[model samples]
Target: MKQPNIILIMTDQLRGDCLGYAGHPDVKTPYLDTLASKGVCFDRAYSACPSCIAARAALHTGMEQSHHGRLGYEDNVPWNYANTMAGELSKAGYYTQCVGKMHVHPLRNYLGFHNVDLHDGYLHAARYGSVPYRESQFVADDYFYWLKQELGVTADVTDTGIDCNSYLARPWMHEEKYHPTNWVTDRSLDFLRRRDPNRPFFLMASYLRPHPPFDAPQYYFDLYKDKPLREPFVGSWETEEYLRKDGRIFDSKTGPIDKELARQAMIGYYACITHLDHQIGRLIMALIEQEVYDDSVILFTSDHGEELCDHHMFRKSRPYEGSCHIPFLIAAGKNVLPDLKSSSTCHAVVELRDVMPTLLSIAGAQIPDSVDGSCLLPLTADPSASVRPWLHGEHSYGEFSNHWIVTETDKYIWHSATGQEQYFDLKEDPHELCDRIDDPDRQNRIHELRGHLIDCLKDRTEGMSDGSRLIPGRPYPVTLPHATAR
Candidate 1:
């Protein structure tokens, strides 16, 4: 059997339920929907840590947060892994290359790829006071330098007048071709055209859009400006934290500053996704034109999901479905993996950690014992196959510090800082609106899930649990190994 070329497409902060195939009533993602129709889609995929840095740690290392040591969003921590998915594929004679957003520390660190054309967009930490900024490697900020090259020295993220983390909406200041999403696709197509054909290639086309600054091209933004959008998910028991007047523009933790502006942000967000979808279409066409489409395995997913005003939350790092859930699709071309079912949806609870093993499996490469993720190929072949009974996920975000135990049917969450517990019947309320923690009939289920959470954290350093019960309000650092101490 011949090894297949692999293409991994990742978008940052994209919600899992926003796609047309996922029954989203508003957002349009034709390209992704088409790919999902021909492949296996994991309906319960999630980001273990629900933030860029920590989520990527799981994707890159194939290990859970507890083992990877990135308990939360910490930037500039060195990526010192001895074995990575790309390294394993490269060792097995695959030409590995990455085109965008590695998000590893030291910015230039390629992990184990043969080459990298990096474009990590608008990282405030790396741009301001972080070590990568202070070391005078500002030239290493590839997207910034490239933008300046095209628009001169005055080109800046602020030129769009939108905060990186805020829900403010705007169109790209320049032409559509100059957008980072388009640039990522352009470089990826260039790679497809120039890749070494002798060896099967592993290419990662990572995009840093549909994230924030809500800056899609004007035409793309126009696609949804006047269109109706579904209102954000708001729970009956949810608090009104978004109503607080924080007055901070760039880093406002809450959103829906006004319902009208929030709708505009939704327009921008959906437009960015559609624009990215079009770019993905172009990349696929390039592959077909290069005559490699029939021998390729293409996987598409996001690092984590965006809240988009869900339960008054704007950004990620929460335990809610809107923050943690993400899209996971694996599509093999006609000549590759012909035995797998088409248009199948797997209900197993998978996570970013599963990606490394899946890709390695496709490449016929060895997975190290250090990896905690299981290969998803078995589940793809037999949809009834179960990977694990449940998945444990959490993140540290001030008041939102939370840990969750999720299965195919229900979820139990523990907010460590507030000692608040919430339970939802995922089978009944996939939107997670009705909290059932207080339901008398479900006490036993809640206790069982809480026990699962306790077992998940008993071995960790934060002392999240005693032998038999959970401990709340026990504070832990946002970054393990402590970012401030670093």
Candidate 2:
């Protein structure tokens, strides 16, 4: 069996339904659509812990959120896991390299990558003196440093006057070539020229766009500036829309009150997706030029999804579909066609943790027993193969802290602080605009789901549930002792 080269391309805060292949009404992602047509698309993929740090813990370690020990976003925590995706691949004689946003603690813990040309774009936690001076966070990121070296020290993301964590939209301050998206693509393609060809390579091209600041290059912004965007999903129980009537535009977690500003923000966000798609096209062409296009296995996904004002929520760390659901596709090149599926859709619930084992299986490497994710190869061979009966997801976002369990046909969510419950019939109400918890017809279904949720958490140290019932008003800590304390 030929050892296949692997390319894992990840985007930050990209929603699952925003892609053209996903039937999005306005977003133009032609390159991604083409890739999906030639690959297997996991239509119901999710992030277990819908935050940058915690979601990545599941991705790198191939463990569930409970086992990985990060239940929410916590900065400056060390990433000292014994086994990692890159480390295992490297041990199997693969050259591992990473480019762009790795939200790992200590700023520059290589995790398992042999070489990392990092470009973590505009991390507010690392920029505000939160990390010590000895750490890499105190210094400028590689992309920012390179931008300054090319255009002088005055060059910065602040030049656009857009806040990194806001709904404010703008074009890049400089040329499109200097944009971080292009930088990631550029450095990633450069690796193709520098990699040791004697060994199979594992390259991670991680792009930090479609997240916030909504900064796309001017040409990309123009692509969606005049298009009509689909409105965000609003539930009957949602109250934040009218409550957030006014606030500072740059730093507001609540999106703009004005309809026009919200529309523009959507335009900027779509532009960023299309811009990223074009760079992906460039990457594909480079792979062809290097003559490795037909011998590689390429997977594309996002860490988590953005709310974009859905239910009046703007950022991540929520249990909603717009925050936890993400896009996942696996495209096998021509040389590996016999071992992988093409132009197929898998209905099973897949998550970030599955990527490590799937790639390891493709590489003919050993999969550790501690991995919580199952190899997706069986599903590729038989789309109806059973993977998981249900997927559980949660995150801590102050009062919005929630835990949820999703099956193929329905979803159940519980708010830890308020003891509130929401049930959605996914098959009938995919948008989740109508909460069905209080529906008299669903009392039995709700009871069954609650029992499942309790069973899942009954053994945990958080004391979320006893064997008989759920314990309300008790929220689990964001970071467990196994995560960073111990």
TM-score computed on alpha carbons, candidate 1: 0.96
Shift of residue 177 alpha carbon in model 2, Å? 0.8
- Candidate 2: misplaced stretches above 4 Å? 136-140, 245-251, 337-339
lDDT of 2 by residue, 37-143 (tens): 88889988999899899999999999998888999988777777888899899988899999998888877788889988888777777776545664544263678
lDDT of 1 by residue, 1-486 (tens): 999999999999999998999999888889889999989999999998999999998898898887777878877677787778888888988999998888887788887899888888777667665454433235776777888888898887668788778788888888888888988998899888788888899999999888887998888888898887888888888877545664235455777667887888899899999999999999988888899999999999999999888887788998988889999999998998877777999999999999999999888888988899999998888877779999999998887799999998999999998889999999999989999999999999999999999888888788878878888888777666532221
Compute each candidate's TM-score over C-alphas: 0.96, 0.97
Model 2: ten consecutive residues of lowest lDDT:
241-250
Show model 1 residue runs off by greater than 4 Å. Answer: 130-137, 245-251, 482-486
